[model samples]
Target chain A: MGSNDLQKQAPNIVVWVLLLALPLWLPYVGGYMELGSRVVVLALAAMALNFLLGYTGVLSFGHAAYFGLGAYGAGMTIRYLVPSTGVGLLVGTLVGAVAGAIIGPMIIRLRGVYFAMVTIAFAQVFYFIAFRWNSVTGGDDGLTGWTRLPIHLGFTTIDILHNPVAFYFLVLAVFAVAVGVMAWLLRSPFGRTLIAIRENERRARFLGIPVDQHIWISWTISCAVVSVAGALYALLNNFVDPRALYWTQSGDFVIMAVLGGMRSFWGPLIGAAIFVVLQDYLSSQTENWMSFVGLFFVLVVMFFPRGILGIIRRKVAS
Target chain B: MTQVVLFNVFNGLIVGAFYALMALGLSLIMNLSGVINFAHGGFLAIGGYLAFTLMPYVGFWGGLVLAPILTAVLGLIVERVLVRRLYGRDPLYSLLLTFGLAFMFEDGTRFIWGAQSLPYQVPGWLLSPLSSDYFFLTGYRLFMVVIVALAVAGLFYILNRTRLGMRIRAGTLDLETVSVLGVNVRVLRNMNFGLGIYLAGLAGVLAVGQLGLQPTIGSSLIMPSFVAIIVGGLGSLPGTLLGGLLIGVASGVTTVFFPSATEAVMYVMMAAVLLVRPRGLLGEEGRF
Candidate 1:
């Protein structure tokens, strides 16, 4: 609040403190540690989705492909890769990255509704492959017993297996790192190219930028981030199922990003937090909660079409 | 093998009829308004529920006709108040805006109807059994085939023979030009949207017993209807018929042969269609 504190600290540092302290406090006192962690994970996924959809003007209805892939990868790798949570996460991220690279070229060629439909189909195929692949996926029961990150401070090794406190920190730490990376990405020269691509691909092409390649990379990065969320989600639930990768789950993340406002670095985190909390609150109240949610979604699109962040931006601009 | 084939064929034909009904309406609205009415299915659901609600008072036939007419009235209102403002804006906004409307309408129906499945029964006259030497079929299915055939023929005649049809066709090609030429394009657009929605409503009413009515039920049907639109070759009636038959058969065959892969069949088919023929099996180039 004072010039002395402003001189002593940077804005980003204060933001990090706020992000970390909330998880720490929520776990220790508020006692909604699990719900908070879940929100954080969803926020991370929603943020990644917003990059391509909201920021880049691409709408993908099949993002669950990466999410499901990441979860399944993490779950399976942990079953064999053993004891190291970080390695399992790496395994999932890399697997998702590889998958994204392969699917990226095929999907990027489409536009508007066609693109949306293709993504939806791809997600369904991903679900079917997971669902029907009984031998590897364990046929819907999902591979379980995923090991959490074992934190070793050289002389002290803290087993994070099923520890809510440890898991919260894992999610929080990754989220913080992702936010920093995403912020940097947004500010980078390459990010400017992405904006160019979004505004007009033909013009961006005429300007000598490799627009398709840029879109592909953005999509790859987007899917990679979602995969990481999927990994953490698998860890949180201690189970992996094809349901995670279902088309509906993909829609859920899209809804979150749109609700929070598609424009900013902060929109998805706020959106995800609000969405998860709202659903829990609303679903508890009525059997027709979905109807209410659908109505809420309509109102959001019609009234707050640019999103809450967009609202904030307008007010600030004015 | 013959029996299975026959069943698949029958199933395909019947399902194709439903697809044509919905796709016809969707294509009409797109043609006239230049907006892809995403809420078409919502209107369909409303029409179905309206009929379901009216069953106590008017019986089956009354519900069928009245439900769609009521839905068309709602469509008329939507076009006037909300959708008309979106004219000449980006088609994307219309898409998003209509999606929002769809969400609202779906939820509103759920709130009014309650969140449970409702059953639709075939009336006494339509309940008679159909006996054939080669195949055994429900008289209701045969009745559906005949009714849908008549609806399609009636729609075709109206579009070709009527002055209102000429206005809509002219409007679809270019609304601004039509407006400049002294046609009431706004009124045409409103009536076109209402007409499109009425078809969805009728299909919804038809779907009562087959798929039943639920809040989220129409959501699932949206994809298939879209598929029908795609297959039929955007804004073409004949193309839609051929497309619907192809899709229905493809799905029925795939479902019969591989139950697990059944759900994704339509999507897979759509992708294949796009790659091989972007305008659909019956669509012309530059349509997309």
Candidate 2:
């Protein structure tokens, strides 16, 4: 029983070990600290999406709206309201979460393609606002002139602004907490019910679960976590743009979730790592990288729908 | 003030016609195949580009006639090769596949044609204003509306009177029963996809004449089409048509007043429609 339990925990342990050592090995592989931070941030977003998509059986093609909102919230807060990084992050998260909660009731009853279409359409509202609201959002130029502030823990200051390693660590720390909460939620009874709904919604409804309400809660939670990732993303770049809220950006998160193995806990992380590295490499290599990335999506959907982890699990099981 | 309103409303109707054309294609595919076809806009771009490429050889009318047919052929091939494999699987795979195709289509168009927006030339006669007072009512704009009306009329006629159209409608309601009744469901779906792409192609050709030709043109237009579908009601084609025109007029009117809110007004209308009727103004209940 103990050995079996260890086997189940093996992927989690490996994932944590690799994430912790990313900054150390990344440079050796011709990658940078910022790249590592990006992988983690994107992985968090993908996993948050997978919580509702893979676990709850709901798909949101508009998650980038909350993500963009979180980024803009953090950026604007730092640029206009407060220079404190922590406060900006908090406010950014609240803004995204609140928006998600409000939008939840409007879309929760929709299923499948209709749900996706509405989410994509709803996200455009935010995108256009960011694009057209020139005075506040900096219009097409994006929010600029604001940098992520250093942390002052009373006795000492962590100069994350100047040091890439400090910023990477800070990102990792937030990622760990957010991932931990998601893991905990998935293991709880609430998570089990979510999985039940995923497997068969009609059966779950017959079993007396408040399916729509649960989905709404799951959707809200996923949006909040994704918003946290968005906040970190803004701080990492110290900028925010409307492209972050575009529907294509949401597609990226979904691709990461699918590429990693949406069914597994650590799958999206693996997907994010591969995707970020590939994108970084491809974009550097050519201007036609969008075509290649699009081609990659097609290939993955056609041949690798089970994802890296899913394929591995099947091989092991066989 | 009334003249300005009239001008904007006329402009809105033209824009709404384009939206309705695209939305009708999208609605057809969504209803029959249960696939949202995120690459619909990409296909539209292809149609426009094809028309542009064919213009030097065939002239304007010839390009219009041939571009949509060629685009429909491509659509048929795409459905057979890529989209057909995932019909029974989760809808997520198909959505992702088409989303990728959209990226490819946009990038492909950019690579083939320059990224710079190109002029789609209409005949000199078509460029002139119809009246001295209402300069906005150009001959080309009027022609576009007429073509849209004819195309829409033809589409309804095909769906209501043709055997293939009957099969499509029947399949949409119950695919299993239709297949059991010996209908070639695969062929039905493939042809349905082709028909839908034909409309997108037509919209693309018409759109370039008004908006000019750009790689991002399809993506820009796709969202409003989605809005049109949602506002029209999911299962009903007529509802989609109404939804498209309503939003177009709403945005046009908004342009007359709050210029900045022109793009946002349709979304506002959509939100209102969803909040009050959820199924949409013309949408049938339980269709989604």
Candidate 3:
């Protein structure tokens, strides 16, 4: 029992240690701060997606809509509303949340694959808007001429604009808060209900849980978190495009969650790390990278369907 | 102005026909086997590309017939080897597997044929407008519409009349009952999948003539097809057909007034359908 406890705790310790010392050892491993930041941003997105697919037991294939909404929301806020990065994040998150809340009712009736189909279809509306609304959105070339500004924290002015390391830390702090809230929610009664619904909806409904209402709420929360990830993504690159909101990007996020092991808390982050790194390397190395990525997806579904964490957990259980 | 409107409406109907054709195939597979076939568009691309490659050896008419058959053969192989294993498992796995295949198929086509759009040649007579006044009605467009109509008629005839069609419909309604009655469930599903792919292949051959052959062709048409399935209601082949045409006309008409909202109009119609009748216009209750 004691050894089991130690084994369970080891992953947490190792994960934190790696994250904390990433900057120090990254260069030694031929990695840069920007790449590290990209991993965190994508990991957050995948984790946010996992909040629905993994934890809540919902499959939303159109999350890129909310993610893109957050991005555009943040970009538009900074460009048009205010120059404040904090305000941009807030507006961006709210925009995604509001969209999700509105769209949830129309889709809550669908189950499984139908729900996924509808979500993917609905997501195209946003992509079209972004592509067609050229004056504001910058169309296919992407929204440019905007950059993240220095953050003023009352006492100290942190110049996240100039220093890449500062930006990475800022991203990390946001990620921590977002992930912390998700963890706290998962432990609550409400969170348990979400899991219960995922496991067996009829049973949960029989137990007096308002299944549809709870799912709608879960869907909203998932979209909201993914939107925050989207906002962070825009801030990371200082640009947003229609492709960011496309269905293919949604597929990428789903693959990340599945690749990491949906049942585990940090599995998506691990998956994101591997996927982002592989994609970065592949895109740099070959023009046929898409075929490789697609092949990777097939291979994973065939061989690693349980995911890394799932396999590890199984071994431990046995 | 009237001529332009008529032209677009006619054009929309043609586009809608393509949507209906693709969605029908998708609906067939989904109804029987419970797989979304995300790579249906990819199969469509393969059909078009195969036709392109074979045109030198087998004339356009020959390629048109042979390409879809070839594509259907490939689809059978895929369903048997890869997709067959996923049955009796969660629908999620099948969707994901197909999604991956979609990616591979897109990239594979691009690798083989090059990413650039290739022009597909038709007979010179087919290119000319049927009449000078309503110049939008080219011989090819009319020919496409007639072919689609024939295909739909043939499909309905098979489903309603033939033994294989009855078996498929029966299997869709109750697989357990059909299997208990001595129908080979595995072969039934494989054949059903092939039937669906045949439609996709047909769409591909028709589509390339109008849209030109490109790797991204499948991805582009996929969304509208999904909308057609949703709007038509799940599990209803006729509804899928109607939904495709309705959205096509809607978008076509939209171009007359607000050109920018053409694509958005389809989703708007889908949203309206969901609002009014969530089960869809002709969808059976509780089918979803």
DockQ of each: 0.30, 0.91, 0.79
- Which segments of candidate 3 are over 4 A away from where they belong? A1-9
Candidates by lDDT, descending order: 2, 3, 1
Give the candidate order by descending DockQ: 2, 3, 1
What is the TM-score ranking, best to worst?
2, 3, 1
Which residue pairs collide, candidate 2? Answer: B233-B283
Q: What does candidate 1's lDDT look like per residue over A1-318, in tens digits?
A: 898887545545765676678755765643487788889998999999988887677877778889889888888887876666777788888888788888787767666655665566567667778887778887787676555567777898766665777778888888877767777897899888888888898899999998778889999989999998988888777788988987558767877887788877678878898888888888889866766666666566567767788898799789
lDDT of 1 at A208: 97
Q: Candidate 2 vs candidate 3: which has greater lDDT? A: 2
Residues A91-186 of candidate 3: C-alpha lDDT, one tens digit per residue: 999999999999999999889889999999999999999999889999999989889999999999999988989999999999989999998999
Per-residue lDDT of B1-288 in model 3, one digit per residue for the tens?
Answer: 999999999999999999999999999999999998889999999999999999999989998899989999999999999999988876767888889899999999999999999989977899899899998999999999998999999899989999889999999999999999999999999998999999999999999999999999999998999999999999899999999999999999999999989999999999999988988888999987
Which pairs clash inside model 3? none
Global Cα lDDT for candidate 2: 0.94
lDDT of 2 by residue, B122-233 (tens): 8999999989999898999999999999999999998999999899899989999999999999999999999999999999999999999999999999999999999989
Model 2 in CAPRI terms: which quality?
Answer: high
lDDT (tens digit, per residue) of candidate 1 on B1-288 = 777878877887788778778888888887677677768878889989999889899988899779989999999998898788777754545665676667667778888987788767767666655666445477778877787788788788878889888888777667789899998888888888888888888888887756778977666666676777765667676787676667777777776788677656776776677667767776766644
For model 1 chain B, where is the 10-residue window of minimal lDDT?
Answer: B127-136
Better of 2 and 3 by DockQ: 2
